[model samples]
Target: MDDRIIASLETAVGATPDDAVLRVHLAELLLAAGRREEAVRHAATALAADPTSGPARAVLADALDEGAPAPQAPAEDAAGTGEGFDWSRAEQEVGDLAPPMYADGAQDPQGRAFDVEHGDVRLSDVGGLEKVKERLEASFLAPLRNPELRRLYGKSLRGGLLLYGPPGCGKTFLAKAVAGELGAAFLHVALADVLDMYVGSSERNVAELFRVARESGPCVLFLDELDALGQKRSLTRNSGMRTTVNQLLTELDGIGRDNEGVYVLAATNHPWDVDPALRRPGRLDRTLLVLPPDRPAREAILRTHLRGRPIEGIDLPALAKRTDGLSGADLAHLCESAAEVALMDSVRSGTPRMIGMPDFAAALEEVRPSIEPWLETARNVALFANNDGQYDELARYLRKRGRR
Candidate 1:
């Protein structure tokens, strides 16, 4: 069957080297077959064939990201901001850990998102959320940013932080900004990309990814949707997921060596579902609740989307004030809705016109905050699952918002 699949892909590639989709499929197949080098080659070819292709980029990123032991660059990059780390021996370590099922069953880990790139948007780039910023500054950033003070206090940088909140509220965005603030390479690992594979293979993948992260020092490994991987052991029936969680615990504890420069950050919408083991100190112990965007944040998002677009009489302050409870995405949709209204109106009148407050007003009615349901659900979790007061921050936010 492997031979057949390879033969078919080879024939297809021969028939059409210009077909980017076929090349991407061939790349994914090669990757699933454990031919990392070939997979990367095909993915690069596909990307060159179609520079605008998203799948080609994805395949290429996944190949570069997971293959590990990529060739090292000069100590300093063109930006001269940070030096690259050597990932020279990653492939050797992973080869031993990789299970036989991959070659036998053909379970592909690509096609899922795994991105590692540099970030430039700093914490200041984030709109508002003063309290959130303050908490992060005190807990996550202070140690790295203030090395002298950190040494005076004997603070260690090896630890994990878990950010929990409703979806579309910028948990991932904040993670990237945190990386940007540190000027570190950001590796975004969607947990679903790692967890649902064969037995022992999932654990190997988790271990290998962390190995890559450790080698790539000053790297911010942002694991989004962590609950799926760390779901409560009692509630979960899968032994494979449980092993993955244990592997995560081991990696966090820095079992063999120091985790000095590799900062681990994870975000999940359902913190309650995450395994309690993962929350123990020296792991993902510290928790921060990322709530809906405040008025200032909404305004920032609106302005960002509206910039360079023709508009008039758009009272940003008024709209921001009225848009209480809207998430960043919700605010973006509101802006899009208003722009769509103006575009349609211009078409009907056969005269171009700028978007106005009325269109924004109509958008307000159409796009109510999608966070209310999340808030309601959060209220229950905060109130009932206030076990040991972990959800105290959430409870306080709910009470302050008068939604409790």
Candidate 2:
């Protein structure tokens, strides 16, 4: 066997790793050259790619004829499993040859389908929104904290709480804080995590999602976008989506399932778009409105985003006051814009300077409130669609802000 010919073939196999025929040819050449170990590796990879390739199988057997075992495979071919081919060990050895199949939601170390995150953010970490906190305490937290009082008063933990507000107002963060307050695991899911193209798959995902929450008792299953997931069934055209909604409803109702310790929290920017069935008595019945951060919260958010950045003469209170309608995300963008202005100035003038009020003023002119359109839609819902007074809280906020 010529070494140059073998090297060229090896390079060709490397370029097209999935080409089983090319790999078999290279393996045969390597085997003829008495490089049995390398031959075995290439043969195993070829077999993995095309399981039905008899040539690859023949070459693999021939390479391992005189006690030359597979690379990373055990000395005993059986691996003590009474099987001819130790596929599990072979997979362990050649796993890197092929990428893992399929990408899914958060997985644990043991490769469990769903990951239950231990909550680290307590309600105290959430700045401002004292009124929203008070509502949570009254409706959800206080009851859970006092089981005896809850039992005596017949306060069954049957329904989950819904958080509705403009986007970027920290609804998801608020739900995590609620989880932290309970010292439970947090399972944050979104629309993409559930819906599948195949029939019945979406429903199964919904079921599995609740199953994980139930197993991780005292867990907060925070559904990020409820409007899309639980869209009004009448309005939704796809039968798969409608069935998915039904599955979610069944899980929320705790039909034939224990939900005592599973806390469900859902958030939506357009609550009006959510299925009314989802808001029935024993579902996501309770609603909480999450508005833009108040002054204290604005100051805290600004300080948080600007903590590590070089700054001088940054009046946080004044900045917060000026950013009245901006959401937490908008505030973060403002900070980034301010930093960019300072960076550009340093780059142009060849002299570095700390970010000052002027940088923030420049950022302010660019980064306006992103939630105005959301507020306008909400105002329409509050005024025209408040037949059940579900959006009364929202209407009040709009009226107070003169958005009504």
Candidate 3:
């Protein structure tokens, strides 16, 4: 089946050499077939011909994962005779496009310095979601900004916020941005680091984490994947797991008004799985639903991802319009796809060109937004488990979107 599609697309591209869209189509087909080299070649050709093509750029971005680009194809063009093409030159051109994807994130926090003064990320850097930003202002930021008023009204310096959403919708990014916004240090905690195989050790780890947060006042301690740390006790018959939840609850409330300058934030894809005790007032009580990136946010995310890469004629507004349901991570993936396509095309045609729109279109068609299943699950929970109106916001969103 793939052979037939490739044959047809190749013929179409051959008949109309200037039809960059056809080349993008061929690039998508080749990419799907795991022919990364061929895909990048077509994508590069498409971009070279029409540098403004979004699909071309999107494909170019995705093919190359940082530091691990696919090997270039043979010197000869597989589609036609290699004329006016320099294979080595084209390969080199692609090498300069995609920087290492993991260079910014995924660093081990244990080995890294996270001093508050070292953080450069600010809320302004976070694009779109004005509503989320507003919520943060009212519930989280207002007191910090207006401390005199907060003191007059009897508000505390510390608070707990639980960010809940589908996977890859920028929860962790938002957490860091919040820390940056507040000029606070960011402490990212993972369950694997806290969970111990020995009896009673996991509880101790939780205590130590809280202790570290208390000592590092004015810090944002972000607990990634909260569901793992505080899952419902009824569901887990394991005594160790229940103990961890109890310890977490104790830490959240603190023993002697101790959580004083530390702000606790937790993110979870499965909020319903979190123990009910954790959601009670004064714990991770405030839940903000981080939906898929809205249109404006999607545009910002795309722009951020493609900023340093070799890109041309990208209509970010138009691209964002086309990618209505994609998450922040999905937009990042689209950019990567664009780069990958350009790289492959550079090798095939022996001409490295800037990424274009055709590559983006091709990649967009292949990479689906990973939000549907999450929404489906959320819808069920909103309808059935939201007995106390806790998920009223989610229910309203589902109904507005006609998913309820």
Per residue, candidate 3 scores C-alpha lDDT tens digits across 1-404 of 98998998888888998988888989988887888888898999999999999999988887654228568765655346665567556666787886543465457454333323237677787789888888988889888878889989998654489999889988888888888888877888888868889999999888878777776777888999999988999999999999999999988888765787788999999999999899888888888988888888998899889988998998999999999888888888989998999899999999999999999988987899888899999999998899999899989888988997
Q: Residue 11 lDDT in model 2? A: 91
What tens digits encode model 1's per-residue C-alpha lDDT throughout 299-324? 89899989988998888889889988
lDDT of 2 by residue, 328-395 (tens): 99999999999999999999999999999999999999998999999889888988999988888899
- Ranked by TM-score, top first: 2, 1, 3
lDDT of 2 at 294: 99
Residue range with the least summed lDDT across 10 consecutive positions in model 1: 104-113
Q: Which pairs clash in the backbone of model 2?
A: none
C-alpha positional error of residue 372 in candidate 2 after TM-score superposition, expressed in Å: 0.9
- Give model 1's TM-score versus the native structure: 0.71
Q: Which one wins by lDDT: 2 or 3?
A: 2
Q: Which candidate comes out best when scored by lDDT?
A: 2
Cα-based lDDT at residue 313, candidate 3: 91
Those runs of model 1 whose alpha carbons end farther than 4 Å from true positions after fitting are 1-114
